[model samples]
Target: MIKKLFIIIACILLLSSCSNRVDKGKLNKVGMLVPETINDQVWGTKGYKGLLNIQNDFDVDVYYKEGIENASAIEHAVSEFKQKNVNLIFGHGFEYADTFNKIAKKYPTIHFVSFNGDATQKNTTSLRFEGHAMGFFGGMTAAHMSTTKKIGIIATHSWQPEIKGFVEGAKYEDPNITVLLKYTDNWDDGQKAVGLLDKLLDEEVDVVYPAGDGFNVPVIEKIKEKGLYAIGYVSDQSDLGKNTVLTSTIQQASKLYDIVAKKYAEGTLQSGNLSFDFQDGVIEMGKFSPRVDEKFQRKMKRFVKKYKETGDLPK
Candidate 1:
């Protein structure tokens, strides 16, 4: 009995150690790094919006350097922020993961946050988006909304887990529903995206989901031009076209930033990998277009309910 009691105590202590939330005292200045201009209305812009909100609510001095791409530029930005003695560094996007991992080790005094990041370091926190749920929703929605019973996903890269989840979701909605996957080797090549959309449209894919940052703009334009339905990705782009967008799967970056900032203030912020999903109130589907009727909304609501309860895509 005494040995069992000791084992229980040890287990409790181990759990506590694993979640060692250190109080860094009061935070002063915060720094932000984005690969693209904050005004790009997508990934970079979303992070910038979070910084703005952090500044407004927390009353902390916030400095950001946008349009800084490549590893050297990121390294330079980190050095500059370190010199400024910033309390926290927010590196927006997975691209900053490696750089943050390197810099966080060198600057152990400062806390590092990577939004949609993949670093797993002692001083760095990686906040990743669980996009599988989003993808499932996209597929289910497309399957329900598609007139041709065919949907297409135009992404910057080929299939990942999220894309697979999307395909699974569509198949779950309708086993017979056809999902076409296409990729644009270049994220900045809107024309390539448009070209891919043309092919999908030709193949009778009436519902199109564009899954790139700004590359989706022209793809959405093409969908509108063809009078086809569109599903936006990464950001809410309902207002981008002539109301052809059925809905958008969005990452609520501001809410993420707010959570981290509040946690930091509460001295409960731990350095590790954190993920946000639909269950976490981070990944969300934007307002549906008029094209999506009330019945479709009800179906989506039911699916969401089931997914939330099971943490699995509705079978």
Candidate 2:
């Protein structure tokens, strides 16, 4: 009778242990929330592509919702994902940070990820791109290529570190280079950005960096019309115009998603804010325009190789 009791106890313990163990392989359901439509051909499109990559690589059921900008909308979306038993959720932008933090407490088993924001909870992670180095390179290209020695950067906000990097890089290339900096206070104001670009042109600025994804394409188009040079942002804009666009500061969002998914599958994805850069293959310079002289292109290649090796940009 005691032997039978012992057997029953062992069976109960085994069942309990089985219930407590999380099969990392069963991390099969993933969800993403984006602030706008995924067809924007820049940031949104990159994020959606990342999601698709995750779906393909992990064979997971992936879900995404567009236009989830507000906390209320985020809550609703997260709740829907929760109902569907999502194991991981991506917020896709910095705006989702606080909302994800608050909601994460309610869904402790679910992990949340976002971009360019603070992560205070154990279940949340923020992925910040080290864009400053790429921005610095863009500035160097502008300074090298500018005919008038005057360049400009039209950015979406003042808090961007890339703005400082651009200025520093331009000055490093040529101490006398003039950098006209202006802000749009938001990301999507193409009209205002174009107006600012005109103002820079008035200053005889021969090169411009329109850093807002929403407005950069149109601003680059305008720059092309004026026969001026431009530094592309977010994606490779050489396809837009080989002669007009010098090069692009690229963020490999899809590759990042693949990395994160792999880490999660390996049970190594930790919660907290994480930064990725050239070393991580997350940040890189896109193809240089043929308009960029071969000498300068060779110089850029050397600099990129050194940076990747030493985590140092051109001094």
**C-alpha RMSD of each candidate structure in angstroms:** 11.3, 9.7
TM-score of each: 0.87, 0.91
Candidate with top TM-score is: 2
In model 2, residue pairs whose N, Cα or C atoms come closer than 3 Å (at least 3 residues apart or on different chains), thus clashing, are: none
Q: How much lDDT does each candidate structure score?
A: 0.81, 0.90
Worst 10 residues of 2 by lDDT: 17-26
How many collisions per candidate?
0, 0
lDDT of 2 at 159: 78
Best by lDDT: 2
- Give the distance in Å from residue 117's predicted Cα in candidate 1 to where it truly belongs: 4.0
- lDDT tens digits, residue span 1-315, model 2: 999999999999988766754344747699999998899999899999998887766667899999999999999999999999998999989899998888888998788999889999998999988878888999999999998999999999887878888998899889999999999987889999999999999999999999889899999999999998999998989988999999999888989988888888787898998989899998889898888999999998899889999988777
Residue 52: error of model 1 in Å? 0.9
Model 2 misplacement above 4 A: 1-26
**What lDDT, from 0 to 1, does candidate 1 have?**
0.81
